[model samples]
Target chain A: MVKTVASVGLPVDEVLEIKKNRILPEGESDGKKKRISIVTGIHGDELEGQYVCFELIRRIEEHKELLKGIVDVYPAMNPLGIDSITRGIPAFDLDMNRLFPGNKDGDMTEFLASGMIADVDGSDVCIDIHASNIFLTEIPQIRINELHKEKLIPLAKELNVDFIWVHGANTVLESTFAHSLNSRNVPTLVVEMGVGMRITKEYCNQLVDGILHLMETMEIWAGETIEPRKPIISEDADDVTYLNAPTAGVFVPRVKHWEHLKKSDEIGWIIDPLHGKILEKILSPVDGILFTIREYPIVDHGSLIGRLLREEARKE
Target chain B: MEKKIIYEISSLYRDNFRVTGFEFGEGEKSVCIVGNLRGNEVQQIYTCSQLVQKFKVLEKEGKIRKGHKVLIIPSMNPYSMNSKERFWPTDKTDINRMFPGYDLGETTQRIAAGIFEVIKDYKYGMQFASFYMPGKFMPHVRMMQTGFENVEMAKEFGMPYVVLRKIRPYDTTTLNYNWQIWETNAFSIYTTSTTEIDKESAKEAIRGILRFLAKQQIIEYTTHEGYKSSVVTDSEMISVRTKSAGIFDSKVKAGEEIAKGQILAQIIDPLEGEVKENLISPVDGIVFFGHNDPLTYANTAVFKIISGGI
Candidate 1:
């Protein structure tokens, strides 16, 4: 089934619409069943989640016998932002993620946010997928506000992901869709991977499998008995260390992501673009495994080009 | 005046990003002024730059009293300012929201950490802050209630209003709230506009800061006796919301006195040019904030009035 989330009349005699795809199990008996919502592309620039949405729908269509619960997928909530490849909603020029639990009678962005929230309200488990910003690559991971770790960690571990980072002090956590949903007692896992405006097929497939496994574990689908994939998770923000640019130049990276390096290992260099001279040689500070590295090279001073997960940084 | 680079941020193509602070005097850290943590904060940055120009002359003329240090940073997010982007261009994050940041954290976090490391120990921290909502405000001094809040010191600014807001959970990451938590008498000065510079308001803001400094005995300049600021808690403000969405034609400006049931604005249908609804004042008071945006949303706050039975 398909539904229009919201519609706005455009000035040029056209209409802008946000749509959602809903998939239900066949021939229901008694009306007691679970519903899981998989939302993605709230950020118009992050498109990896769209692929996961497609894969989830495709797999469900192929294996109808294994499906017993309801699946709702919001592929692109900000249709105009996604269409224009912009980071925020068009016309309003606002971040939809920051306007969650929105006022129904508020402005355009808030109206859209309210509709999106209402569409997913009362779901048992909600999943928000995202791709990292355009300038970097990321391993598939789940992110939660540090405050929600005690209640959310076990739920996050159910999904197939490489890392789980508990971040601190972002006002977005109080206003974002996942956080608002969690506050309403609905558990949500925010997944991130790949690069913005692009799709990582492997990451999408991995998360799709994880989602299916979680469904089985939740007894929504009784066809297959599945074991939860234990992922490398960190409960504190300090488990990952960021390496930033040292000078203004074209950065040339020497090591790939997910590679291990010793302290002082040469990871990259900043070249003075005009003079073709070496400006600064970037090196690793501690013995750690690099999980995030800069894919797009043009950076400013203090720009994050790499992130390292320390070997033994997590608190036991 | 000595310009010192407090923190260095590495860039790939442009020059190394640096947060530079202009030092006026050389003893104890007395006051630190910051502006433009995000782009679109033109009024804040403009006001601070004017103060910097004024402070330079004051320092040379021996107006800055001895044994007191003053620092003014006109901007902390020059990259975003250059592009007219409100947040960090690459990551789309807000630098203002990352206060007392972690050195090993993300890019914005590191920037906040670096800037906070230099200014956190000051006796007073003042920021020319823009409102989260795009609107016009009656020039005021605002302080968060952090248990260490000093409302009396805030009144020294002599702005028309000294607003006290109990901090919300979201405010924990903002610079104003963190400064108070760190024991600095922190206050945020809100001017009239965000994107456009109102020279009149800018002058008024400059005078207010000068008045505060003179009151604190940090400077020797004599300024006009501005308003004996009225302390208003956030809860005391009465908000007027729009009943319909359209082009908003405001009949009242900020700081204007109004009686109950007075017409404040009219929402007009943009296409047909017909009046949709009239925004009337619900309380007899002074306008604390008048929404400056030409277009308004239905049920959105357009006017806030201080309901003092004056």
Candidate 2:
């Protein structure tokens, strides 16, 4: 069944509405059933979660007899952004993700955010999905705050991601949806995958399998489930090395993404297209595995080119 | 006045990024004024420049108090300001948002950490801030209700209004909130303009700051008691929103008094050149803020009015 989570009056006699798809156990109206929320599209350009939402519902309906709990899929949180292909709410130029647990008495955007948070407040678990910007491509991974490590890391392992990054807490996290839900003890896990403005079917399929496995673990689904792959966990901040551009130019990668490299290996070359000369040679600073790589070719000084997980940290 | 480089970051391709500070008096860290963390805040930098000139005269005449020091940073993000970009030119990150920042973090964070480290221990912190929306504001002093905010001290500025905002979760990362957390009396002063310099309001803001310094005994200068500032919370303000997306024709400027049901602005259709909607005031009040942009989106707040007279 479809339900409107938030509605606000817009211009031209228009109304902006956020809707969600709720699937429940066959013929069961029990309010005590465990519920999981799958949320995405906080950024309109990140559409990886759209396919996952559709696939989750389609498979659940296919095996309706085995469903035992509630599943709510909120695909488009910023519908205007999705419609206009903007990263944030088009007219406001505001990031929807930054307005979590918003003020009820504030502006229209804040009211909408507050309503959405209230609607998803009491879930057993929530998976907040996101994709990288158009400039970068990220492998399937889950980012967990070190503050919520003990309670969240074990749950994140069931998501079939390639890596689990346990990062230190920052003031910025207090306004995020996952942080707000976790503060409420809802056990929200943030999943980041693929690149913005494009969808990778393989990553979506992997995440779907992982979500089903998680559902089975919670006894929300009694159907068959696959065992999720064990993910590499990173806890120390020093274990990751950031690669930034040395000069402004066109970046030409010489190495494949996600490849292991030794110290001083050539990762890429920043070339001056107009001058026909190599401006700078990008190299691996340490023995590590590259997990993040820039997708766009344009390079500016101080632009992040990639991130490498130290090899020793991986072994640990 | 002595000019000094407070923080510097060496660059390979260009001149090093430097945050420069002008010191007026030489004693205890009494007050620190920061301006234009973003590139487009032309009015803020201009206000700070005027303050610098005023301080030079005051310091030459020995008007500064003997036991106090005053520091003014006119512009923080000069790299972005040079390129006419609002944020960091390379990554488009906001330096203002990265307050009390991480030294080993990204470029903006490092810059923030560098600047904050030098000015965090002052007795009073003043930031010339701009609104997120492109608008003109009645010159006022704003404080975040962070339990550490001092509304009494804010009123010393003698601005027309003292706005106390209920702190939100995201606000914890802002410079004013962090300064308050660090036990410094922090306030954000908003002028009538941001990108363009409004001479009248800039002078008003300068007078307000000088009055505040005199009140705190940081300087021996005397200025007019600007206003009996009215204390108002952000929630008490009424927002007037446009019903159509079009060219906005504002009927009243910021700081204007209006009656209930008064037409505040008109949204004119771009193609047909006809008024689509006339935004009317819902309450009799003073306009605290008014949108200054040429075009506005549907449902955007065009004016913020403080309901009722002070």
- Using lDDT as the measure, the top candidate is 2
lDDT of 2 by residue, A172-231 (tens): 678888888899898999998988899999999999999999999999999989889999
Q: Can you give the lDDT of residue B58 in candidate 1?
A: 93
TM-scores for all candidates: the values are 0.88, 0.84
Residue ranges of candidate 2 with Cα displaced over 4 Å:
A1-3, A23-34, A57-69, A219-223, A236-254, A262-287, A296-303, B1-31, B56-70, B79-84, B121-123, B181-184, B216-220, B235-253, B258-285, B291-308
Report the C-alpha lDDT of model 1 over A1-316, residue by residue, as the tens digit: 8889776544333466788887778876435579888998888899999889999899888877788888888898888889999877764556778788887766557777888888788888999998987888898899988767777788778788878888885664688998888888888889989998788899888898888888887766656634656677776666777798865567889998888888999999988767879888999988888888888777666678899988786324
Clashes of 1: 10
Tell me model 1's lDDT, rounded to 2 decimals: 0.84
Task: Write down the TM-score of model 2's second chain.
Answer: 0.98
